[model samples]
Target: MHRFKGRVGLCAMVALGVVTACGGSPDPARPAGEKQQEQQAASRSGEASPGEDRAVTWANDYCGAVSELVRSVSEMPIIDASSPRRASETSGELLKVMVGGLDRTLDRLDNLGAPPVDGAERVRRDAVATYADIREHAQAALSELSAAEGPEASRDAVSSVRKPLDDLGGVDLLAGFDTVPALQEASRQAPACRTLTDADPDPRIDSPGS
Candidate 1:
């Protein structure tokens, strides 16, 4: 199977690994769509001028979300291509993990409310939208994998899964946060961010959770 290309999201780090992967359901405490509603409510509440401490908190939260997403993606099992049916099923499982992880990450990012920075709303919206798009890609891949049958057809479908993940690899989820210098600096200090930095030394991008 094709591996994801260089330096996209943390997911790319393990995209090279094949096999089946799964788990990472969204938080059970918050029903689906509640995050969107809460985000909208928070948006209407107006922005606060966060001091240094608050800014650091925001960065830490973002970093924490990212770290979780990476861990989830890394759980995907190695694909067993020796059996077509098994390979197809495992590939589908991996896609499920991708979709679920992205969904959970998006919810976490939403829960972060607005980052404390100028143009915070726009930045948040763009970052969320980017991740949402990636999730959609993974969802589409899952659908394609589900419909596949036969050895040849299933192999083709399994191969298709790489594209969406590759697209994900090309994105920098954290790029939106860089618009605010203060927040960017604050991210450097976040212990969670440091953990991510250690995982993949490349500059972090926004992920579903980040």
Candidate 2:
């Protein structure tokens, strides 16, 4: 009986050693990347145009708000819906309203675009683009979020993209573009603008309450 027990113990040790050997060293897991194929597939399905995003929705609202144009054209005011005079009149009035509305609606754009601030416009746009990019970074960050594998990275990447633009957006628009030197850099290339929240940027400082 003693001899039999000794043989069984020897076999058990050998089996344990073999199992450990086959297990290999435990290594950390790595994150996944956004597959290019997925991007292509989305494009095929009808993705938005390059540089187009929902971030700037105000422009559309501004256009819609200007339903009528009050131009000072000497043409006898024809009330025809399809007439050029009506179209021009509506267009001209709308253009005027847009100046003020744009300043209110797109304060961030106005700040970077109109401000004499250095790199304001470029910085502003790049910041906006960064928000769009962070959505992609989310897929990449999942793989690297674990500390054993690597420190959390994409949060910083996302913030890197959002901060500059958000900080600039915080710059009050009612103050006028003269405060920011980057005003020279502004162009009307942005799409219709909108905000996710109901936050209105215009401060009531200029109001004749005082």
Q: Rate the local accuracy (lDDT) of all candidates.
A: 0.64, 0.27
lDDT of 1 by residue, 35-150 (tens): 66765565577432235456666777776665555655666656678888988888888778777778877887888856566755676677678878888878877888888767
The digit string of per-residue lDDT tens for model 2 on 1-210 reads 001111111011111111121246533362233445645666687553322222122222221121111011111122223643444343333223323333333343433324123444454454344323332332233223221222234233322322322332333322332333322112122221112111332311111001
Alpha carbon lDDT of residue 84, candidate 2?
39
Evaluate model 1: give its TM-score: 0.68
Error of 2 at 139 (Å): 54
lDDT of 2 at 99: 32
Alpha-carbon deviation at 77 in model 2, angstroms? 14
Candidate 2 positional error at 50, Å = 8.7
TM-score, every prediction? 0.68, 0.19
Candidate 2 error regions (>4 Å)? 1-34, 49-51, 54-210
Judging by TM-score against the true structure, name the best candidate: 1
Worst 10 residues of 1 by lDDT: 12-21
